[model samples]
Target: MAFNFFKKKDKDTSKKQDRYKELTVKEVIKATKDAIVIEFEKPDWEFTYTAGQFITLITDIEGESVRRAYSLCTSPLVDEYPAVSVKRVENGKMSNFLNDNTKAGDTFKVLEPMGKFTTEVDAEKKRHLIMFAGGSGITPMMGISKSILHAENDSIISLIYANRNLESVIFKKELDDLQDKFEGRMHIIHVLDDAPLNWQGESGLLNEEMLKKIFDRIPSWGHENTQYLMCGPEGMMKNVEQMLESLSIPKDNVYKESFVQGTIDKAQKETTEGSGQDYEVTVLFDDEEHVFTVPADKSILETALDKDIDLPFSCQSGLCTACRGKLLSGTMHLDEDEGLSDSEREEGYVLTCVGHPTSPGVKIQIG
Candidate 1:
């Protein structure tokens, strides 16, 4: 009788403990002209993400809500105050809200950090870390650069940050101060895309000639030991990638992010406009299924939400892949997606934000 009573007590305790797991909540922390930073706090949530992971931020609109994702700029070391910076984009619903409304102490919803951009710094190897970032996309690279400088004092880091002008550069003062502190250990070159001719730094755009000129001062670090992280506008990144390839840089050592949300939005609009057809989607969760007819004017995600079906999602632009679902049946067309890789798409996963059903029985499993 005593043994049975003890076993029952243990089971009850375990059940109660499971119920006490902390839930995720959004908290507004800071607001600035170019950006706003939100901090998330959950007791049970412990993010073991590396230096370059990104997270999605979801906001509830008055009638219809939209989501956006930002690369986390703050270090993972801060257990109590993990945060990310989001720059406001012109005509963007979420970015405008983040810029105009969010305040410190206000709450917001965010998904867990997810990304593969990372570094493997070893004391045995004399690795040189080179980072290139443009405008607000500097968030993740900032975290990585700071982490490298903080961890290994001897490691060399050369960063070239491009912006419209001096006032628009994020973390400008901080980077300048860091340069003063680190001296030769870290180097920063600011490139202005649009500036007065009096601009004392490099101008126009980053290209092979500028990259070669900058690196000419430093020794020729072999491609095997050097790592490059590039984050910026799609055009800038693509140009830099081509230049690096022409320079015989290793493909595996280069990293880039699909942060171009505006392009994805344009592609989505174009696809829907050109399709000229409407279809229905059947979503299955648990044992129950829900069906809804979608219009060509709206995305599948929007249609599902309009029908009052709660679906898990972040970054409605299809950049975060938070709304990825398996295509159990039926054919679908996608606009533009940078979230899922080739493998995920080959396995029949689709980003619902920009996806539309082409067949009648477009079924997807949901939770």
Candidate 2:
């Protein structure tokens, strides 16, 4: 019933102009102590997202609004209803609301799934995947790892998970079950920052020495053809990247997803006093157009959002391509060129999250 209503409304609005969808909770499962898996019945939901893409979950609070993006933990083609596993953070407004207030049959708006952190499994190429996960950052990696293991039986996956203690590990039972199901194809090693007083497993951070020890047990440590995925705290990723560099691993073979949030307001404030120049932005939406003035320091996304035009976005950190759009005209300066491919940028596609107009007039197709 909820799916039908949302689908009707979405189609009607989308036919008239641009519109977004709100997925309603069909069921909720207590996955772990801090994690809740909320399943939404999107029968009409077009599951077009890539495996590791994330959706921004939005809810209304006192007529104000709150939202936080969570990566989907299930594969796109899974028969299960569309769902995402959320971890509640202490003192976090959205997390607390999701953990405590959200229940089965509740409805909430969700932005379209977007993110560049995805896996492309090549069947012909013998692929070996290495993933490093920490805390809740394991969400996307879980999706990719599970999909690869299930879809391509020949693919090898090695996952290194770090948590404070055994109790803190999410999907502990499920992963263990999968290991038993698929013997040698999948490997998972859990590292604890502080072990239980009686714990006997690996007791230490996922540092160079620990990784080396684990790699010795499994020889595919620095395979040239392997793809490396690093997702976790900024410091952890940096440390891992440094370690990989020391091993002479190719940089392009390595992919990273930072579970870091950007301070958009702080970025805006820092650029406020720049006396920066102005640029004209031509926004093309629904066969109509609007002209907006953007400060040289402000990104095109910020300019559009400030004008109440809902442009797509997730991590405004220029990592996710949620705000990606084709440039119908003109050029722009990008802060971090992480998500944009060379061809995409050459063809004039830009990530508006961190893109500032470099020229006087820039025309773009806005969602």
Candidate 3:
């Protein structure tokens, strides 16, 4: 949740991060009807990764270069080779292709792991982990639950996994195995909107009442210090956060991450009328400089990519710092700044994905 497991480093790593490498696929296991588990051959060279972080997969979609990030579903402690889960979506071009067309022996340019939705394992103190997942959001939660169980000596996990029905649930067999292995330590509650008749588990969408009932039945383990971690569609995440607030849980112990920008409303795009002036933007990336003109209404990353300039970025929703860079000159405004730390902004760093030029001649240094 709010904890981390980073070791002391001799030097700064951010400047050396965000590199990409090609890895061969080892195998593909069908986790469910709509989801597939992709396993990669562990690289001979060093490429260590955390459990809940995601890697950007670069591919060609109908002659167009495209990049999409998928969370690593396999636990680093449990699996030898890194693996990720992909669920087919109706219009998700990359997801459908990966789930249906990709196979063993295939190769992909996978960027190094990057993300902040993580917690450390502490064997000294008992840990209580509470997780909420909806649909495909179960991918990261699976890794987190397994990592904690495998690495920590004193910890218990409680999972509230929601899906349309039994058939749509991903990782059913794997989760069942974990439950069997952990026994009383692992408690899983399934919430299905549609199910067979006489199903004993909870049914219907998850609400405040349903969550309370599930928690009431959960085993006791340091309730005052429990950690709540969540990832899902925007609306479900909001409801869970509200419920946590009502319970008077400390905000510091709660954590969340969204793969897409679901919280932003349609009205947010319709900003108040401004001067409507075009601004001059200069971006520096990969030791190269590109100068262009971007409308004040458009984001710097959008304008740069439109002009055929490649800049490192993932999760355009501003939840990841991949597109982060130093502001060299001029002024810009960010629609959202959750990923960027206060000290980072104070040091003139910005997430160009959501940063728009507020004045002319803005200079950005994208390392």
- Lowest lDDT block of 10, candidate 3: 1-10
Q: Model 2, range 41-106, lDDT digits (tens) per residue?
A: 864667577778788887887686776788887776543766788887878777777888878889
Candidate 1 per-residue lDDT, tens place, 101-159, comes to 77644555555677766675445446788888888778887678777777775688888
- TM-score, one value per model: 0.75, 0.84, 0.88
Per-candidate Cα lDDT values, in order, are 0.71, 0.75, 0.81
Candidate maximizing lDDT:
3
Best TM-score among the predictions, by candidate number: 3
TM-score of 3: 0.88
Candidate 1: stretches off by over 4 Å: 1-33, 36-48, 60-64, 78-80, 118-126, 152-155, 180-183, 194-200, 207-212, 215-219, 262-298, 328-330, 359-367
Model 2 poorest ten-residue lDDT run = 1-10
Q: Give the per-residue lDDT of model 3 (tens digit) for 1-367.
A: 1111223444334543446678789999998899998989987657777888888888888997677889889788888888888888789889988987898899988778888788876667578999989888888888888889987867888998889999999999889999999987788899998978988999987887787787788766554769998887777788889888987878777888777764544365555115576778888765556677777677888877776566788777788778999999999877778777667889999989988877777988887
- The alpha-carbon RMSD values of the candidates against the true structure, listed in the order shown, are 8.1, 6.1, 7.0
Residue 16, model 3, lDDT: 38
Q: How far does residue 36 in candidate 2 sit from its true spot (Å)?
A: 1.6
Best-to-worst TM-score order: 3, 2, 1
Q: What lDDT score goes with residue 227 in model 1?
A: 86
